[model samples]
Target: MSRRRSARPAPRPLRPAAERIVDKRDGQWFVRPITGATSVKTYTCPGCHAPITPATPHMVVWPVEKALLSADAIDERRHWHSACWTRRH
Candidate 1:
């Protein structure tokens, strides 16, 4: 009698490192880079107070804290131009 062998499972794909944590004097910030291909809407940059048009590559920043809830963090998030975010003091 011939025995049947089970098939091996497919390996999981590795996830990209898309988000980073930045420590500033004010607080710990979670920054995510938005690629032009994925940016779909316009946003006002808090750093320069200018409009970030659709398809523009930018950074999205939000403060992180033990006491801060997920909803609050989302509400506090801001979109900034890459240059402006880098230059923010």
Candidate 2:
């Protein structure tokens, strides 16, 4: 028997996720069509210049109890696997 790959349609990437700005104060994410200091910028990977997509840089600020904490727990940049992120490095 031959194995068949799952045939699911590609999901539409979130517009804001594709282009976003995050409010660290409230852990809220704002989608922006333009690029700014706060907006997450997509760049070419240093190793291969392959385009890299990083989810908007956001801080976890929710549930009240978790407020006032440092910005260290958010895994905001995992869109690209390590191999791709550091391919050139």
Candidate 3:
């Protein structure tokens, strides 16, 4: 007896590139767009020395060149308020 195979749809392709931001003074930072569906985490802003509350929408930044490993660098990344980050200069 011949068995029939069930057809499955192809998986969606991953994003080609991630959005990144580069600040001459601040080095580089990766941009992460957070949808409302995901839980938001709070962080302290290094620029203004203020807290970045959850669900507020902000930026995550890390040094462009560091001696630490990538994982460690990411771990050292800082969260900042969008406006504050823009006026960081």
After aligning candidate 1 to the native by TM-score, how far in Å is the CA of 43 from where it should be?
0.4
| Candidate 2 per-residue lDDT over residues 12-83, each given as its tens digit | 774542544444454454332323334365755434556545553322111222334545434232233335
Question: Global CA lDDT of candidate 2, please?
Answer: 0.40
Which candidate, 1 or 3, has the higher lDDT? 1
Candidate 1, residue 57: how far the Cα is off, in Å: 0.2
**Local accuracy of candidate 3 as per-residue lDDT tens digits, 51-84:** 8777776766666565455656567767777777
Clashes of each: 0, 1, 0
- The worst-scoring run of ten residues by lDDT in candidate 3 lies at 30-39
Top candidate (TM-score):
1
The sequence of per-residue lDDT tens digits that candidate 1 reaches over residues 1-67 is 9997769877878564389899888889899999888789999998889999999999998887634
**Candidates ranked, most accurate by lDDT first:** 1, 3, 2
Q: Is candidate 1 or candidate 2 better by lDDT?
A: 1
Per-prediction CA RMSD (Å): 5.3, 14.9, 4.2
- Badly placed stretches (over 4 Å) of model 1 are 1-17, 66-71
